[model samples]
Target: MESVFEAFLSFYLNPGFFYGTVLVVLLILFISIFYRLFPNSGFSILFDYFFEKMYDFFEDILGNEEKKWIKTYVVILFFVILISNLLGVFLEILVPVFGNIADTDVSLLKKYIDIPTADINFNIAMALIGLLIIIFEQFRALGFGKALYEYFPIFGKNYLPYTRGNLNPIFDWPLFILVKIFDLIISLFLGLLEIVGHFAKVISLSFRLFGNVTSGGMLLAMLVGAISGLTLTYLNFEFPVLGPVILYFQSLLVALIQALVFPLLIAIFIKVAKFA
Candidate 1:
């Protein structure tokens, strides 16, 4: 178990692990304070209303039967991605405030805080988890036997029903045997393709998120690094500052879109599996 935990930690390599953990704790405290101060205020009412709307939007896709489970999963996924994305902004804020106080080098600060979703390993892990949920839903909806048949029909008892019971040895038996052999060959070929497709799903999902978040972070980092470098080299305390502002806003938009898109795709995958 210890080795497994280490392997998992190594896989994620969360740059913001410490800072992110601290932010999460601060977030919890903020929410607690908000509830205490304005339990019946318009702000709290509006917040609940917005949450309900978001929940209903996803619930509609999942339908009434599985809405609760699907909504819960989606909500959690959305917030996780959102928090990871916002961590970039949080780092930006902290750098200016804490940079002077901590007296740390710019490079050190950059190394410390990272958007978790920007890490390919983290995205891959999330994609794999989503895939597992998809598979679990398939099994829940179709049962083990039917789900297995969906993937590899040749092993299923009903794949060639005619070969199950005895038949006339001279006539019916010969045709049955031939059909069974043909079915087996076709199923085996399709099963291989099906396995490949499932693996493709994992890669596709992971890369989609990893590419978006990583690119956004790279752009932001380049902007900041360039500005900071010029300031140090030129010995100028002021710069246009518009470049970083524009980049920051762009990063914020990308973060929101990517966070929403990841969970939206997962929900769609679940829906497809349900109907498959």
Candidate 2:
């Protein structure tokens, strides 16, 4: 009982967990109120443009009119990642600096400077959701036989991806049987590998997002620290300001591209599974 209590407290007391929960709740509340109260604000205008652009982007990737049903999900996913990425850059900087307020118990926030998407558990959870969606979409779009066919194409078909049967010019009966047996074993091996590769996609997707976001957050944190710690004796003009500005744009591009790429790849996977 004591160990269980300690475990529960450790998890619930974590500053990162607390900050993530509070910030997400606050963000959702602010957006709900902001849109309802001020429909024509500049942020609303910007959001409208972003929505249209993202619609076109997802439509191009997932083109069929039948697939339009998922547009809302895709758009929401893009915004979630993009917003989290943007926050990672700003909050990591802000939380450490302003989080030290003595009057408030929120000073614990300083220790939780890492971004949400930077956490491996968070990325893996999202990736697992994608995995579930992939399975569901494949089954719904392709039906059970065809969807299963994707992984076991060579098993029941008695055919390889390429031409087969008697590569030897001469009619050697035993040699032909040997060749077919070898090819059959190889094809079965490959089909099993295909199934493994499908699950591996989740790991690849998780690691890609985790690595990019975490690296970007860490890089920005270090750059900010180095710039702020610079001495007067080291330099006069602040050319150092340009370093972060340039890196900031680069991180912005990375964040946007990754946000798009993760969903785009999922769409492509579904499309391929359907067609296969």
Candidate 3:
């Protein structure tokens, strides 16, 4: 367990993780201080407004029954993705200073100061966790037996043989055999398809988040590189002012959208599972 914990920490050695962690900590501290210092301030008012909006957003989609437990999960998922998406923008401001302090080149720091959502491993893990929650919720709503049949409906009673009395070899044998064969084929096909669909959900969820964030990060990096090269080669300015401005606005919008979308989809999945 100790080794496993150490390995996890090693994964965040890059500047992205450093800045992301610091920003999250600082955000919590800021909120705490504001709440304590001025309970009736605009900061609290704005926060309450945002929280109510988010609560209503999920509550509308999940309905009242599920809104109780599932709201917590949705909130957690939204904030984590939101922070990760915003991390790239924060890195834009902090990377140069950190690079200089570490005596590392700017080029090296750029790669390290990436958005966490851009990391496929993080996206995949989050997707898998969402998938697992759906499965677990289904099992809780419907017992294990029913949940098993839900995923592989072929195993349900409807597909099984209805053996009422002793079979007649002459009259029922042929028809019974045909029905059994047909049932087996249909069940196998549907079961395999259902299994494949579950796997596909994981792939789709992970790739959707990963691809969007990664592409945005890459675009920002490319713009920064191009602008820096041109300015250094042709102009007198050392910093690329346009790149940062563009990245800030673009990343901010993308971050909010992706963060909202991910949790929204997860909530939908949970709803589907509950109804299924």
Candidate 4:
């Protein structure tokens, strides 16, 4: 069965991809409907509890708004990332158009629709979007002038702690001019490094999401293959019987880790950008 499944996966008929996509859409739809129908339930109470907790957490960090809009943003980002990551678990079963292509056959990219998150472009886009939001939050909080000043600390007569009443022009005036010039140069370079760091965030965020999801699915696949190999050779069974159970448990762990990690990272980022 493992060999057969691998052969099927190797072929272009990637039913797993389609199934995963459908499952994601359905999952979101069902969750939406469920929440709408039962606006108040045991489940909803738990949801409200978390919402309040998140609100308070962000409120303490942000101090600007009593409401936890940051948490809400992080929640939505996590949901999208979680669904994309889970798509990998079934993507192999989905047939690809060129999976079995011969040397003479025409090649088309459309034939391969693996987990969308596996592609760097998708992950980078997600990170860029988050970075944009963070930038907006910073600007909104600090205002343009102050935010810009943070990146470029200018020096002048107003640079030091001395008062105008100090009658030490010979020492203070020349020292102030020299210090201000040095500060301006250093601040300018630091500002550029900060801007470059923004792009680095995109790379970090994208790779982290893609790597975690793909590796988790690959691990599950290996586990299934191992179990099937053992059962077929020793027990001569058609199915391992325990494959699904083990896979489900592993999947649950992966799903929860990915979901929690992504959002938690986002929240941390919000704190860094907004507060730090």
Q: Which candidate wins on lDDT?
A: 3
- What does candidate 1's lDDT look like per residue over 118-218, in tens digits? 66777888988988998899889988887777777765334555743466667787787777787787777776777787788889888998898766665
Compared with the true structure, all predictions reach lDDT values of 0.72, 0.70, 0.74, 0.63
Indicate the residue-level lDDT of 176 in model 3: 71
State each model's C-alpha RMSD to the native: 6.3, 5.2, 5.3, 7.7
Ten-residue region with minimum lDDT total, candidate 3: 98-107
Residue pair clashes in candidate 1: none
TM-scores, one per candidate: 0.72, 0.77, 0.75, 0.67
For candidate 4, the TM-score is 0.67
TM-score of 3: 0.75
Regions more than 4 Å wrong, model 1: 1-15, 25-29, 93-106, 155-183, 224-237
Stretches of candidate 4 off by over 4 Å are 1-26, 38-68, 86-115, 154-181
Lowest-sum lDDT 10-residue window in model 1: 98-107
Error of 3 at 239 (Å): 4.0
Question: Per-residue error at 259 for model 1, in Å?
Answer: 0.7
* TM-score ranking, best first: 2, 3, 1, 4
Q: Which candidate ranks first by TM-score, i.e. highest?
A: 2
Query: Which residue pairs collide in model 3, if any?
Result: none
lDDT of 1: 0.72
Ten contiguous residues with the weakest lDDT in model 2 = 155-164
Which is the better candidate, 2 or 4, if ranked by TM-score? 2
- Between prediction 3 and prediction 4, the one with superior lDDT is 3
On residues 7-68, what C-alpha lDDT tens digit does candidate 3 reach at each position?
66667565555555566667667776987889799979887777678988898888887747
